[model samples]
Target: MSMIGLVDCNSFYVSCERVFQPRLCGVPVGVMSNNDGCVIALSNELKALGIKMGTPAFTLQPLVRSGQIHLLSSNYELYGDMSQRVQAVLEEFSPTVEPYSIDEMFVRFDGFAHAPLLEHARQLHHKVRRFTGIPVCVGVAPTRTLAKLANRAAKKIPAYQGVCILHAGSAETRNLLQKTELGDVWGVGRRLVERLALMGIKSAWDLAQANPKEIRRRFSVTLERTAQELRGVPCIEMIDLDEARQRIMTSRSFGKLTDDLDEIREATRQYGQRSAEKLRRQNGLAKAVLVFLKTNPHRQDLSQYSPSLVLELPRPTADSREILHAAGLALERIYRKGYLYQKGGVMLLDLIGADRQQLSLLDTPQSDAERQRSQKLMDVMDTLNRRMGRDTVKLGMPTPGAAWHLRCAHRSDRSTTRWDELPKVRAL
Candidate 1:
């Protein structure tokens, strides 16, 4: 029997913060999304306080002011750095480590015996915590679907002690699945849960016992695969972690609404540059650029206008200059003069591998030397931003007090990335 283990970090974003601020470990802590808009991550204590995920900061002001709950702005740089540290620790334990998300990894323990497999999982849980200060639960089972369930069991069941291993066709596995709700199963959405419930498949075990072909006939091939996976048959193919994205989007809500064209233009330009950087990192080129502006839909009193435009690039390129120029033109076409904009974004669409771009018959052929120079310039800019901080080598100066800047007043320091922001320890 093959053994696959899932390693999932506990309250990942909140845990990342706790590593730097130990005082927050026992307190109710929540992490807010961009512009301090809404709660995105929460600790167990915060959940117990009845502060649900996606609750706006303004709604939780009373709890915050009373010092009953602490909400910090999402510091992605710290969380991403911490996630990499956890992954680095996992690589030491398994030959095949597939990152399922920033906080979840699937590892193969194919050759291990049952007893040794359990022991190895415990060691992994300990090592990740010890090395990265991020607590993780490990679930080992016959298939990836079962592995995910096992990991959840390790988290929710106190008896598991943060590690759960289930073999194929085990009585214990069936018992656990019976207790698991249909909605809790991986890949089962709310609508699917309703449909499955109507068909008397109310729990994970019920779905596992379902006929795979019947499920496919009634629903989709994807749901059929889920059923197969539930039966300890490996059907879902693991995606390569480094696979290139088909499209890249960079967007965020502004600090405040503004009708100033220059402010929106600057935001669009920044978004385009960021999207281009992502394209270069993945070694992909964008054939089209999309620029969009959105108004506050919740503000019924204000005049609303949301518009977007897509412009094809003259040539498939990952060059930020070309991308930004196209974005500016697109913005000019879609942007209205009177409406207040709350959010703006840029998307790089119709992406292809940088080396796989097809030449058009009427396209002016660029020299190899010119392409190399453009690539080199972007490389230098990216390197400088990495070595220094972001925006160290951008195309234009940002306007001071720009309304489009994110309103992250409670964001923690970027301790892992910026030199000056590193945490300081005092001798007591």
Candidate 2:
């Protein structure tokens, strides 16, 4: 009677772009990396045209020039907004929904004995497509692992129209497991695939039928759980509460290489601000920050320089000012004035929820009232930024012409939120 549903967006980033521009339908469109560097997402048409992910733009420039592929810069803002909308819609369908990733969610569908699971999934798909213009594939199974395999099959088979249901002990379910590639199964990464292949577990069905004891002895509990999940046993449960992030890192490749201390400071400050924003959004504080600078790894003829500095904060704080100050100090220690630096990032570690913080008596401490007031102010700032456009109230750290601002040539405006930069859709 246990059931789980995996809802996956089809080529999510490209699909989101196509939704806004209907003309892009049936075309080979792709979304690029931070600096329009490489292909990160590809449409079905582009995939069929032999375009692959992470192929540098320069390498694919010939194909791009031939008009065989359409490209767009990564628009995370639009994609994030759409992802939230999809999550909101999915929440209405089930009491317990887990957002698995940016474009996938798993929902527990118990206590609905009479409800037709496929029909329900179909309705959900149609509603999301109609409202957001984003297509999705839904997989229903007794276990989460099988549900993921079913979703993959759903995308390949046109008859299902992006919906696959794997009932327990069904022939269709067996066929699905057989057809799925061993490498495609969840938890079966490249290294595990090679190891499993050596053991003659070459297919998903094989792995599913392997002895659990052997898997546990040879591998670990993680792979053992995967095997059990494949056999229609639910090992992973729906996570109602978001899990704590083990690490938070904000990194980017600069538009150009430069080692000027002022430019380095500007970039480090931007990275720190970004890291701080993530900390605030997650309602967590950072205990330490790591700042790193590296020159182009490819340029070996020139002496390559890469160094990082880690600094522990006096008090764990989510304040941008405090984090940036620490990051700037770290950067000053690591930055080499002569070498051109191509990339830099800030990593925040030892994160814990704001409410569950363990205060230190020996450390410089703020009173409970003062701490509450500071948190409230930050909450207000975040809320205002979300309701209005980002950076409406500027933080001096992210000032314009800061050396690390993304080189967005065709950037879209915050049309929905910004009054002055509203998008104009032409009517035929």
Model 2 vs truth, CA RMSD: 2.7
lDDT of 1 by residue, 318-418 (tens): 99999999999999999888798999999999999988978667554555667889999999999999889877799877798899998889998998888
Which pairs of residues have clashing backbones in candidate 2?
A: none
Per-model TM-score on C-alpha atoms: 0.95, 0.90
* 410 Cα displacement, candidate 1 (Å): 0.5
Which stretches of model 2 miss by more than 4 angstroms?
238-241, 356-373, 397-403, 410-421, 426-428
Clashing pairs in 1: none
Model 1 TM-score relative to the real fold: 0.95
- Report residue 427 deviation for candidate 2 (angstroms): 7.2
**Model 2, 72-109: lDDT tens per residue?**
88888788888888888888888878888899999888
Q: Where in model 1 is the C-alpha error above 4 Å?
A: 359-366, 426-428
RMSDs, each prediction?
A: 1.9, 2.7
